[model samples]
Target chain A: SAVISQKPSRDICQRGTSLTIQCQVDSQVTMMFWYRQQPGQSLTLIATANQGSEATYESGFVIDKFPISRPNLTFSTLTVSNMSPEDSSIYLCSVTGGSEAFFGQGTRLTVV
Target chain B: AQSVSQHNHHVILSEAASLELGCNYSYGGTVNLFWYVQYPGQHLQLLLKYFSGDPLVKGIKGFEAEFIKSKFSFNLRKPSVQWSDTAEYFCAVKPGGSYIPTFGRGTSLIVHP
Candidate 1:
């Protein structure tokens, strides 16, 4: 089992501002995933963060808008840049090794 | 593309009522199934998972799920529910040979005391 500690449980930001959310895991992992859950919707994968290489983003998500940084195996940060009202959602950090996946408490971002 | 479908979006039940949440996947080959629960102000927690073994798998909090390969369904069931069981439940499906899993839209279960 893995435990994740995510920062900024909730944040209210203004438009055009950026908010970086941090995720720290109790153990080192090979892959870290970032997800966004809009109201009344399921989780949407934003990107996959690896320790050495650059983050692999999914379709409809760009690095400039959602830049990810994985400095080490146990830590990663995702920045929501140039926030808009549409960007207001819950962002979660997840790590999977075997069959089960562990998720962070999630960061609730509200852009005004 | 593989996807998971959850039939119920919202459900309201009285205390001690039976509960069932439907989950279906698009994959035909081997797959891994899971059910997760998220209470208010909490993270997603695994309720149960089915890798391979008995079709009937029991999970935490007396929740159980049956994996039917022919129908491609893994539905969650609980005979009796309490008010504390009110939360959002999500079903996830990980296709064979894939590490990442696809999540359903989720079902909000509201148990009335």
Candidate 2:
């Protein structure tokens, strides 16, 4: 299993402001992903952060709203742009190693 | 599109009682299955996974799941429940050799002492 960590374990932000969550892994990995878990709902894939290229967004999500950056194999960042109350959710970063995927301590974002 | 479904939204059980959670996937092709557990205020952790070979897989905390390919189901079971087992359980599926997984709505298990 990989040891994953995320910055800003919890944060409160005003509407129209943006916040960035960073994920760092203990070792190099081939793929890193970002997911959103809304209150009382299951997790939804936001995007696949690919190193040196644009992240692949899932349906119902776009790069304009959730821009991602993967500068190296062990690190990636996801920025929630122009936040809103509806954007309040727990953001998680995960990586697949071997056959199982490991998740970080999610960042809980609350937009007011 | 592929997806996962967990039958129970919430389940309550007493210590020493049996526990079972149903999970189904909607993928026709070969797929990989996983079960994750999230304790209160804790990150999600892998419980068990079934990629191939054995249909029955065992995980930590005395948890086990059987993958029935014919029914597209993977159900988790524990012979005896513990109060500390209260948590949210998620079922996830991915296509064969695919890296991305689709997660279910999750089942909240409350085990009473």
Q: Pick the candidate with the highest DockQ.
A: 1
State residue B58's C-alpha deviation in candidate 2, in Å: 1.0
Model 2 docking category: medium
Off by over 4 Å in 2: none
Strongest candidate by TM-score: 1
- Which DockQ values do the candidates obtain, in the order shown? 0.84, 0.76
lDDT of 1 by residue, B1-111 (tens): 789999999999999999999999999789999999999999998999999989999999999999999999999999999999999999999987887889999999999
Please write out the lDDT profile of model 1 over residues A19-99, one tens digit for every residue: 999999999999999999998888899999999999999999999999999999999999999999999999999999677
* Per-residue C-alpha lDDT of model 2 across residues A19-73, encoded as one tens digit per residue: 9999999999878999999987889999998788889999899989999999999
Q: Which ten residues in a row have the lowest lDDT in candidate 2 chain A?
A: A96-105
- Reference-based TM-score of each model: 0.99, 0.97
Candidate 2 fnat reads 0.68
